[model samples]
Target chain A: MNKPSVFDDFYSVIPAGGIGSRLWPLSRADAPKFLHDLTGSGKTLLRDTWDRLVPLSGVDRIMVVTGRAHRAAVEEQLPDLLDPNVVLESEPKDSSAAIGLAAAILLRREPNVIVGSFAADHVIKDMRGFRRAVAEGVAAARAGYIATIGITPTDPAIGFGYIQCGDPLSIAGAPNAVTVRSFVEKPDLETAERYLAGGDHLWNGGMFIAKADVLLEQLGKAEPALLAGLTELAEAWDTPRRGAVVDRVWPGLTKVAIDYTVAEPAAAAGKLVVIPGDFDWDDVGDFASIAKLHSGGRKSDLAILGENARVLADASTGVVISQSGRLISLIGVTDIVVVDTPDALLVTTTANAQRVKSVVDALKLSGRDDVL
Target chain B: MNKPSVFDDFYSVIPAGGIGSRLWPLSRADAPKFLHDLTGSGKTLLRDTWDRLVPLSGVDRIMVVTGRAHRAAVEEQLPDLLDPNVVLESEPKDSSAAIGLAAAILLRREPNVIVGSFAADHVIKDMRGFRRAVAEGVAAARAGYIATIGITPTDPAIGFGYIQCGDPLSIAGAPNAVTVRSFVEKPDLETAERYLAGGDHLWNGGMFIAKADVLLEQLGKAEPALLAGLTELAEAWDTPRRGAVVDRVWPGLTKVAIDYTVAEPAAAAGKLVVIPGDFDWDDVGDFASIAKLHSGGRKSDLAILGENARVLADASTGVVISQSGRLISLIGVTDIVVVDTPDALLVTTTANAQRVKSVVDALKLSGRDDVL
Candidate 1:
């Protein structure tokens, strides 16, 4: 009853960046959201991502693209990852540069390798459904389409982008694959409800799968200078000039998201396909979402995170992230969010969770770099 | 012409106790509310009380009755206090014992010294009004009346007991003194509103002025064994047997508040009068009161307390007591109460501030003595 591995030539490029300011005091600039075990699953989000990809791409074929500041932490979290596959950027040039460089480097070794770009801080519970979607995406990628795994819409969420699915594709081993008509921005509530009820749209979770050579070709077609710089850096990646080349070229590269530079342009040109993923997934965007994730199947509405967190909640419902070794007590406040760290503390409600970014912005404006 | 110091024989006794559980994390069992500067006035409440009393009663005539645990802190906060003026209880025996012991000891020193007992944790802004009220109260006390200062109610507050002023007294130099009709417990909203409109009800702020012998005689009439035990301990207070006498008798004294054991009974016997105090006063019963105190003239509604606290609040209103030297950030929350200490943190709201005692109770039930 052993299932055969179907992604031998697939490489998972994990783009680990973004400070997740909405989950502040837990996710900081130096220690981004990827490093913390936010889901109370006994593993960090990045580590969970590695474990998920290992079953499909194996450890050696997975490449981690992160800032140079997080290189030591990513290596420490993923010790089994190959040192040669760790791609460090001098500074963030957005997803286009991070993912494009990974595709260019992998294409230099294997021209037709299927590269899957997954964010390092997402949460996926169903491994079976994830593996199935990735299998279908890899199949579509082999047929010359830039494939993406679109999450089936479960709610009228105004926080995420939407992908409109067109006619079904006839690629082999990819029965669920469909041509992507377009990628839309996050909509208003009324528009999101219409998209949810219409059943023609899926949430774009920023997961893309494509053949390495095809991805580089698309990037060259869209932004020639970005692709040329990435190709030159990829050529010197294996040599001792990686540090010097990355430092010189990363800051100069055009900053853009993969959705804008690659997915949207390819979809408009009729060169994109999407495989629907019907699994439970979350970006852990705010404390409210984290509260919902940890309160699953539990009678209590209180969600307490951190290994040594000492929390005593009474008649209260919310999320408490206790990174400091202090006792957190909540009483008679519903939908509250309390994040306790050694150097800073955040108190707001679930309704105000998304507004936590304004607090971080105020701190930066006040020149409180110590806490930031 | 220079204004002379009034009431040369007046003695001030400050009863400094109570953990103030409703202000948890900021107020703890080890460091009670009197030890903290809950208002941003650059002085602890106990120190403010000491400074307020020094003009009427010289530093040598001011006595502080606190628990054995807070002896060092109380002494350090009031350095000019005489060594023999401190009355340390092994455990809390309530306000009756604390104030009665100070009265009995003063009675042994001077038979008819006018003793004024004021709680150490109250806030009074108008020192001139307070001095006028105390002078009138001292005059009534000299005329053989157990006088209490009753604050003129500015609002229908249900957090404090109400004192009903009866007929006006015609004593010389005590025009504001009136006979107390009765002392009532904290009332419901409707009753509080009724009292506020009645024009005769005042907040009983637990301030009492009486001759030392008169207070002891009233205590002896109300509870004879309690007065006898206090008298025995007071006889040995200045001797080496002071420790032995206190250890033998203090624990056995009847536990009762000064209002219940003396004020109410003295009013019933027609021996009590009240002096109308037209000054801003607050017991600081909860975070809501503290917020109002600190945000008096500020345009912003947010009230931040603590010397080294670094806070960045945006679109938030309420109180933040940050004693842990941590950066506290709040966003888009209204009426919130955040108490950040070294070992514990409490997150609630001004609407739920009174219920914070339940949090402390839950912590006690969970055996979190380290935080308690």
Candidate 2:
């Protein structure tokens, strides 16, 4: 099940989008979550994700699907990416159209090829475990199933969706893979605790692998109009008509997530399988989660992000500082997050970090784009 | 007894020293608290204090004692100040020398003139009440007793000294004036509560009035060396030898407060009186006090100290923002103070606002003068 041969036919398709409004003042629309290095590492999340998948899929085998606004940034960040391999959607039509368009484009190039879609903003610390999980998923995909890599629940986190394992799949290299019974939405604390205690549920990390034709077949079964539009754009993708085709077709595509349009429906039809991932994973969703990641799994302490930050904390704990080269002093303040930028500052307690999205909404309502 | 006649002979001396370290980032060493409008008013604290006293003391009768570095700013802020009235100290030598030099300089011209010393940064909200109190203090001064304006206790605050009042003085035009029994240092909460419970105690506002010759005579009795240095400087004050005499003698003068060198000793000699001030007053010593002032005497709420600041708050109370024309977002944080400047920002709770001075001290220790 852990054989390296499973990675031979795998291709990586990264769906890079999402402004991550919950991490606002640090994550803006122009420079989003994927473009930022939230883990204090020198590399951005997109680049880190690219580096992680490069071993399995070489530079030419990896494709990135992003909005037209971010196409330049993606190309600038990943220099080796070929122009044809960079799928630029004219506008955002949700994850379903983005991934379906990438699949359709890849199917036009090579039929029956296995394409794995991973988000660009997620952080994967355990590379070996991630590769093993992806290999298992790819093997399951080859066995004619839409396979998803689900993270083993380390904590009863209510912020993520869950996948329930029904029965074990009998794929050759994916002996640990199981048939997904149901895909549940983000649960409450009680349901999350029950899922953790049951041990049959895993956090859906939103990673999926399937044959390009199989994914298009699922999209065609679910949303025929979206599938037809993606197919038409794919037909003109490498031709001189790509710009006109994308501009005409992208706006009419149904704006829905793949999880709702395909995964849930496919799971009802016994077409979805789950491969359990044992690696550390985070989407870097909010400042509180970021504080936890920066603390290196510590209970309560300071989490600093930049190099020029000089912090003096006294009688304070759980202070997350995304510094802007300024000296910050925290005294007697606990469980607070301070994101200091050149133009804007966000100060809040960990309890209210999730409400930061509404702040962005308010800013948009007021037309404050200078900070937005 | 609160006649307008006592104000005609009264001269005002404003000792503008202390850098106000507790309100750092807004009140810097270069631009101290007196120069800032902490109340969101258009005028600075010094200008407000000057305007409040203009009815009692004409612009020509007011004298300002400030550090040599602040001389230019003080002159620019108060253009009506005559050249000889601007007493510029080469270095800070505390309140005793600053006030004593002012008294000696005034004594050289008019020996029997009553002089009042008020800090440049203190806020007086009720001008009529303040003027009445100053007039009563001037009457007590004419009656041959050094008089101090003591505020009616609004709260049991431990940050200020308490004045003990004895029998009421039977002097003309000063019916509310009482002989001062003693001046106690800043008390603990229990002692402050006890003092508040007793109606005989008043909060010392650090405002004093006495005849120019009487203050000089008291200084001569307490610290002869300081008095001698001040007298020699005063004799050379209007002459060409002023610079030479000041350079030789100013540094050797004892650095002490007027309360210790003159008021306490004068009270022990039964030559001091206290005139109760029935007005709203605050020293604006720390951020918590500033927050209270900015709240306009309300219980607990958000207080903003700048016009250009744009704030977004959610489920928060007791927040104070001194903005630097930047947008600040606060979520689910209570009792916090945020002072945002162009170069530095300070975020702390109301309870720990007094600890800001230590933060400035730490900044100085780390050689962060750019932020300090």
Candidate 3:
């Protein structure tokens, strides 16, 4: 096989949504997790994700599919992204609709382009390793496979969906591509441990690379109604009727994850392939992941993010503080997460980091939309 | 036995100082614990202390010895306290000097007057019980004893000094007054338990009642140099030379608690007695006390202070949040204390609540005076 010119017809789709409730108070509706600099890096997670893909898919070829509310922010963060490439959704219909809309739009424009969908909030540590995996996944996509980048499991994590690998694919320029045996939901600790020990399981991080036409075709076969609505919206997307069409059809589309609508269903049909992602990847789903990221694999006693947070950690370990120009003092607190914002503050332990969503839910129930 | 006219020749001295470092981030150098409404009550601790004593000691008869920095705040909090009675100290020279100056000033005005010294930061639950104890203590003072109120031990608490009571005094109208055997420092857990079991130890709450001359004479005996400076400042307190005398003598006085300077030595000389205080009393020294106060003996899973603090506690017990106009969310955090301010935030556990002082010290060390 010769060197593949994969970038020639490749487009990147960044689906940005979710308030990241597990990282509440800091990650609010107006300023979701994607807009935050969770890693203490200078750039926001969305901007970082855009930067990572710029080398593989030039800025113009990368489309951001986000809620209309976040379109201004996305544009402000990525000034180089052309206005036409930003696919604005009227309402959140989950990953399937967000990614499907972007896929449909790209298909209408290029007809034979490969669209790689990556979350705007997830973190990829090694850019070189991510680029290599994306290249392989894109190669497999060109060979009529609904390709997904599967992260090599670093821990027996129960918080993520796991992907099982089957027989290796013989696709050109994709030597590491293997057919996805199955896509499993978030498992219990025992099952996660078994998956880790089995050596064939990988973390499915919602990264999907497939031919735009193939993804639409899979959606058409899986859910004909969702495919038809997306097709109608895509046809009117470039015209003035786009607004009226979306208002009528967007809310009626099925709200489901791409994994449920495409990846898992396509895997059953023997069309999905898993390309191994050797690099470190994190969805930064909660404060625990943010703490782990800040610790830099060293298991730090305290992890502080943002320039204004001056933390004094005393007899405390595994504590994280994401703040807004405040001095956060942690005394004799172990494995606690503190997110301090201008209007709200969140304090919880690492064990209950996932339950932060309950706080957001409770706030919503209590009608505290000002802080929510 | 004739009931003596106690009100005619009685004055109250309130020594107001101490930043309450253990409650740091909320209590600071400029605005100490006495100035804050730590109990979530409408009035501040100083105002509460003043209100509790106003029935026994008339507003004009209560002398507040406070630093020049807090004189304005003290006056603002206590509007009824006469201008001449608000003795402004050039600098803090501990309770010994602060109380001694008040005693000397009252003694100059009314030679045979009795004086009761109470800290301006402590909390007492029952006003009637406190008044009863103070009256009994005043009767003992008339009988020529340096009388102090000893809180009836509610628990084997090792945080307070214990007053060992010998036998009940034989003075009329002083039924609960007992001879002070000794003043022991905060004891170890075993010693505290033994003290509690023996029924002889009561928490010494730094409340003293004595004839103005007797307290001055005792201070003159224990710390002659301190007494001399206090006398010089007191003599000029109502005169034009008050500022000059205080500026010259205040900083040179010995910095010691009245417990060491007069109470301990006076007790050794068979001149001290303890009037058992039946009221619930607390120094409100740390976050644990604040939590306890919030809990109100109900054993609440979470205790919140301050208005506009909406806390969502899940699987968390005994968490405290003193906040600004912000929503504070606590999840799966047990026995944790979260204090949210405009410029500073503190996250710690109830077990480590007392170590909040260490955070303040660390802040000072790190030159974070902005938050301290």
- Which candidate achieves the best DockQ against the true structure? 3
Q: For model 1, how big is the CA root-mean-square deviation?
A: 2.5
How would you encode candidate 3's per-residue C-alpha lDDT over B105-214 as one tens digit per residue? 98888899999998889999799899889888888889899999999988887768899998876888798888899889889889999999999899999999999889
Better of 1 and 2 by DockQ: 1
Which runs of model 2 end up more than 4 angstroms from their true locations? A1-3, A319-323, B1-3, B164-172, B179-182, B188-191, B198-200, B319-323
Scored by lDDT, the top model is 1
> After best superposition, candidate 1 residue B110: deviation in angstroms?
1.9
Clashes of 3: 1
* Poorest stretch of ten by lDDT in candidate 1 chain A: A1-10
Estimated TM-score for each candidate: 0.94, 0.94, 0.93
Better of 1 and 3 by TM-score: 1
Inter-residue clash pairs, candidate 1: none
Off by over 4 Å in 1: A1-8, A239-244, A297-300, B1-9, B297-300
- Cα lDDT for residue A16, candidate 1: 94
Residue B220 CA displacement from its true place in model 1, Å: 1.4
Measured by C-alpha RMSD in angstroms, how accurate is candidate 3?
2.9
Candidate 3 chain A: minimum summed lDDT over ten consecutive residues — where?
A1-10
lDDT of 2 at B356: 84
